[model samples]
Target chain A: MLNHIWLALIVIGILTAAGRDIHEVSQNSYGNGIPWMLQIESPQTISVYGEAVETSLRVPRRQLQLHFHETAAADAVIPARVNLTHAREGVAVLDVTGDVPQQFKIMAEALGSGETLTARLRHRGSGWEAEFDPVSLVYLKKVTNAAFDIAGVAVQIAIGLIGIMALWLGVMKVAEKAGLITSLARIVRPITVRLFPDVPADHPAVGSMIMNISANMLGLGNAATPFGLKAMEELDELNTKKGVATDSMVTFLALNTSCITLIPATAIAVRAAAGSSDPAIIIGTSFLASLTATIFAVTISKLLARVKMFRWDRSEAE
Target chain B: MEIFRTFVSLLSAIAIPALILFFLVYAAFRRVKVYEVAVEGAKEGFDIAVRIIPYLVLMLVSIAIFRASGAMDVFIAIVRPLTDLVGIPAEVLPMAIMRPLSGSGSLGIMTETMQAYGTDSFIGVLVSTLFGSTETTFYVLAVYFGAVGIRNTRHALPTGLLADFIAFLAAVFFVGVLL
Candidate 1:
């Protein structure tokens, strides 16, 4: 089943390696031409509050188009340099008069000095109206060391061959026996039990967690897709409320997302391939971040889950 | 003192592994005792590592291809509309963009994102940090489900996908509103 996918991956690998010159495969993908959407996110709705608030729409020179009058000024859309002064602390609106998109949306948020907001305008009958908040464009401040990027890319390519090499070289049987696969299963199992104690092993969450970890251990994050989803559904069963997400489910998601990625053999090896001075700089960060996020996310989710709305809902008819 | 200690610790972690290899090789030569156990252990590790090497290699190669082909641009573009609908900022698309790719690819992207923006930039840090913490859901699911011989992942896919989605949103929310 994954043969097809793996095959495609192989072709992609060959082509990517071959075409590395043509592709601007950055260690990071965000380019300056596009404006970075700077904003805050809230589950509940955010009201605009005051009328005609002065919000600065920051667009990356790539995405932002400039114009002197009504005539088209630049060949490319980009974050145009603008001259403006701010008043006080509250939301301030700035006059944006230039070549804008016919109909588009810019995701936005408040920023200091250069308050950022996304600007979305529908090319209506008359003129453009704001579809979404004004968005600002921010460029990449940190560039992964080009050499580091090369190393990172190289590691990725090497991993692509790990399975093939393993099968060809012949340690797969030992792997099967050693329960190396259980490392992942062990990590995900108790989490499954904690989340769905009542659910059976064959149930979606328990089974998927097992399967998901198995795939993950095999270095197949893609393969783990179905299992993760099944796990979620089994978890969702505990959420009896509607329109609101449950705390346990949310926490479960956080813990999983913030999963402490123990033993980054894959990454360290990648760094080794790329020829990094410190292949393990990632070891600490990965460990620290994953653990912190797991704890923080789980705690928050658990706290919020204590609210009554997160409980399992029963049918009115029943 | 603390900073110096951290640097020392970090150096030891890096060098210790290499030092062990040297010691093992030395031990293998002296009494040949270390070699006996190590050879057995390594034989096992090497075989297992090699067996999984193909899987690792396949994933790495494909990600390389995705990077090389500019498919990432198209892929990111295709998903851009979906993200906008969901309220994820377009700038932060790199994290979402790299989500489907290998960890290194995403991490590199995350690193750049942090540099482009400030580390204090909520989304920037959240995303970069999140990329490190989170596993690629579909990738993990496919390999594991396939390995176990449980083809009918009908229930499993939804559960994991939901987990991924929720995680994505939570990261965005935590960064967006709280941070």
Candidate 2:
């Protein structure tokens, strides 16, 4: 399944890039008009002008580059604001000064289309002002971005995973050693038995499955993966047909895949790192959402098990 | 309602410590040799982490390719009209699709969205709630089922997708009412 999905992404990326480049070859110019949103706090008159350039089509594609020149009297206290806006899309606000005129480059998607770009300005606490004239910006068809992004993002994520996985795995070890997992398994045994009717309550697979789900709920990601693997291996031991997923396996897999997470520690950490005012605000809503999802996942798997097409055929596996 | 809110907050504050303490206390009472067992289990962590790296990297890279190729944008544009009617914001469509595919990719997208839109905005809450609620279904399937060598996944995929769909809707609904 994943193999096909990966192949599709690469193929679509290459095709889209080739198609767009083909169209670009016929066009006279790759530049699009972008409107600027300017704001100044000082009383002195100010004028700003700029053009966008296409820097590179290689890995880490630099889609657009903007060079803007502003002529204004220097003031230490007064604030200067420059922002790009699209009608339906959001705004990207930048603070600029005449002292150091740095070029700006942003993702092409963030700036919207070439035609609809608008610049709005606000002066000295006045309402937002707009310029009808749009700045000419160049566009590029980045066909290889996906390929590069895949490689780049993989390295980035792998680096992040190393440390996080180590920490969580250590904590999980402590929990498992302390007999917390078995205690947790015992507590949730009733629910687990009801969910997986085929699995004997006393079977070690049941305990492992509960531990996996518990680890998931506690947001012990690394721990959960191992427990899940162990659970599957144990469950497979009882399977009548090797290589064919039994009803119990399907149920367990669905529940593990859609389990409700009580503490979304990773999300909270990311939000807090980004300077969110209240990182934990999503907790209650997220719990409710996960609960809904788990219920649906369990119900759907059970319902689907009854369907003739989805039913397991022991002979087919052979 | 206010009291319930306080209770949740209090619980959240103590949840982690409580869990840790419960384990320690239980093992101590049972004379389970906590320190030795903890060390023995911790030893397995290094190997498990190593084992998962290839699968994790594979999923992450594929997701990056999907996002960078602009196919996701094209797909989103096609679905916008239909999803708009369902109140699924266009801003969150990337997240909904990627949530099942890759954990890191979706996290990056969520962070980017929160940066673009203020963290307090509607989209921010919706995505954050989504990130909190949903699991990386495909990753789970590949790692767990693949470990057991189960080729005939049967109803697992559909069941997982159904759960994700419910999670998406629930995120929107609960955030709408609560936030």
Candidate 3:
């Protein structure tokens, strides 16, 4: 299932990118090879042909409509620096900053530069004729960049986990050696017995699982991850069929993914940052919602375990 | 309600320090040689993290591709009608689809949604509730199973996805009640 889903994402992404690029090309979405007319507002008139001047260019509503093919395109004023090598021709660098059209911003990005687009300008009758660099295959370029970037980012995320993973795993080791984990498992035996019938009541896996779920409920996400990973390692020790997930693993994950919420700290923090009147307003709602999902998640995991396709005995782990 | 909120916030703040102190002190009292045992246990952390690299790289790369190509818009377009039939708000459809797939993507969607709508509006509250209620299923599946080198995840994916869906529905229902 994971193999199929993983393949589907890549195939869908590449195909969609190709399709959008083709559609944009057919529609001349970036207005390739088109010249735009603009009014230049320079503070001083340049007598020397090779002089550079700071100016503002005003793009008319009609030019915007003609280029973007959108009737709602409005007039825009852009700050620019122009260096004229000849009386009739110059290179104008338009600073693509605030209030710029979305298409222009995309075009600037596709040109592989920062927030500045360099365009060739010619002195027309009463205005400057500006021709921008062509932009095509925008979506495909984005998809390619994203794939390469995230591949490295994935390694960074894993490397970032080393310190925290070590800390919590070390602490958990002490708890296990002191017999604190077994005792913790004992206290939760009645619940663990039903949730994970395959494991012994006082097993260390149960202890780690309890610690994970408790940390998760308290919204201690940093602590929860190491304990959760520790729990997986302990659970793996009990697996008869290596490389395959056990019913107990699925049950634990189900519980983890939809664990009951007491604080919902991240959401509240985001709300507060967004200037919410009552950032913690969703606490009750999140709690009730997660509680309902947790109940259903456990039930679903148990029910699905009995299905023929997912039956533990039928699975052939590599 | 206010007091409960304060208590939970305080508890979360102190949980790790308290747990560490209790575990170390208790282990010391038990004559367990806490430092050596902890260092020994920490040894596995590097190996586990290295083992997860290949899995995490592939999983995150695929998700990034899907997001960057804007296939989610197409996916949401196809699923919108079915969701509308069930009375789920059209505006929050992106959040529902993204909640389980990517954490940062959903965070961006949540912030964008709240900015488009008022922060205290029903849609804003609903999206935030949805975000708070469920975990990022794909990420968790990759990291956890990858740690143990589990290749055949059996029923884990489906179970997590179904739970996320239920969480979304429950969020909508509860947020409605709250309003």
Candidate 4:
């Protein structure tokens, strides 16, 4: 199912890009000039003509055109000597002089400084004029570029997970062997009993349920899967309805869905790999969110079980 | 507020290492062959990671394609008004929607979000919190329940959806306060 959807998306992306490319061909401005949308992600100091000034720039400036009248104020064009540099693939780099600092400040302020800003540029005699925040230009770039981006990210992620997953799983193994899991399960025994009243406290399902929840809380996804499956199978053994789910089954699913995760290690690792300054910062917020979700899942499942629409018929006991 | 943020940061810094230390010491006291068990567990972990790669790749690729085709942008635009009312940023709508459907998909989206917004940015933090807190409700249901041949899922779908909804709101709230 997913494979088909993926294929469809690829086809659609190619078609869309092709259609746009065709329209672009028809417009055929080439060197003659057409309106250009400049997307500036951030502003920083860049070397332009042996001088440094804060500006929005991309290197190798062949197509680089500077007319501040678009995203910047109508009168914000600075009277500076434009020094052009190399440009590649329709991107350019350029250095400008004259009241550039003041002009750049005005444009930067209008561009919101820290966020992505888009400006419109159109032919005006030998130069161009630009406008701000034209929303129509926002679209995902080339599908090939996105595919490359995802491929790099996926491999990076898979590699990153290896060490951390190994470390935590190894510790978990020790804990399990030491009977730590059972001890941890004991702490949540009362709640599990109430949730799965049909299953005996000593049943394997109960132990598996506790272990599954604990693994999830510790952000152990791979460890959680087997235990969760085990619990489901164990719970299934006691089910009188062969193909139908029991109340305990539904409740267990709900609980598993909202299990509290204490450390978002995977998320943090991805962030860290992406060069986040503080990778662990999301942990606290994640904990709070997971805790709330768990409360809601457990409570809502219990409440929904009592509703007539969801109540199981005990009269059809096998 | 600054102090609180610092405290939270310190708490996270210490939590995992502390937990590992406590487990090691406790296992030692119990006289479980610690090194052997750890190695064995690590092997299992390795196997699980290997097993998940195909699924991860498929999900990630699908997400990449969906997003690259501008479908995600359209989806976000459509839901922006409703999300705005609930304080969920438009930036995180993909993560929120994908969370309950597929784990790898949500993780991929979160990675993309972090890359786009900068990991420390508010939107990045919000998406990460949402990604970490929620489960792949539909995937879990299909995999586990289907494995047992339970054709009737009863209230699991609704309950899971409810949980995901609460998780989305909670993430927005917690990130707002703490991050």
Highest-scoring model, lDDT = 3
Question: What value does the lDDT take at residue A315 in candidate 4?
Answer: 20
Off by over 4 Å in 4: A1-188, A314-318, B1-72
Q: Which scores better on TM-score, 1 or 4? A: 4
Give the interface RMSD of each candidate.
Answer: 13.0, 4.7, 0.8, 7.3
Q: What tens digits encode model 4's per-residue C-alpha lDDT throughout A74-159?
A: 33223222222233122223233333434333333333441233343343453444344422111234466567777677566555
User: In candidate 3, which residue pairs get closer than 3 Å at backbone N, Cα or C atoms, i.e. clash?
Assistant: none
Any runs in candidate 1 off by more than 4 Å, and if so which? A1-258, A261-318, B1-39, B136-162
TM values, all candidates: 0.38, 0.65, 0.97, 0.55
Cα lDDT of model 4 by residue, B1-179, tens digit: 34754564476566566877898999999898899989987775455445445545554555566555566555677889987886667878888877875567788888898889988899988888888788888667755664576656666778998899999888888888986
Chain A TM-score relative to the true structure, per candidate: 0.34, 0.53, 0.95, 0.45
User: What lDDT tens digits, residue by residue, belong to model 3 across residues B64-133?
Assistant: 9999999999998899899899898889999998889899999999999999997789999999999999
Ranking by TM-score: 3, 2, 4, 1
lDDT of 2 by residue, A1-318 (tens): 334655776666566655554554454122234333333333222232232211111101122222132332332221223332233222223322222222222222224442232333433134233333322222223334444555665556445544544544445556656555566667777787788888776666776787678777877775576667667767988988787788888888888877787778888888899898888888788889998888888889899988886787622454
**Which ranges in model 3 have alpha carbons more than 4 Å from their true place?**
A43-54, A86-88
What docking grade does candidate 4 earn?
acceptable
Task: Please give the C-alpha DockQ score of model 2.
Answer: 0.41
* Residue pairs in collision within model 2: A35-A119, A36-A119, A37-A119, A37-A120, A38-A121, A121-A129
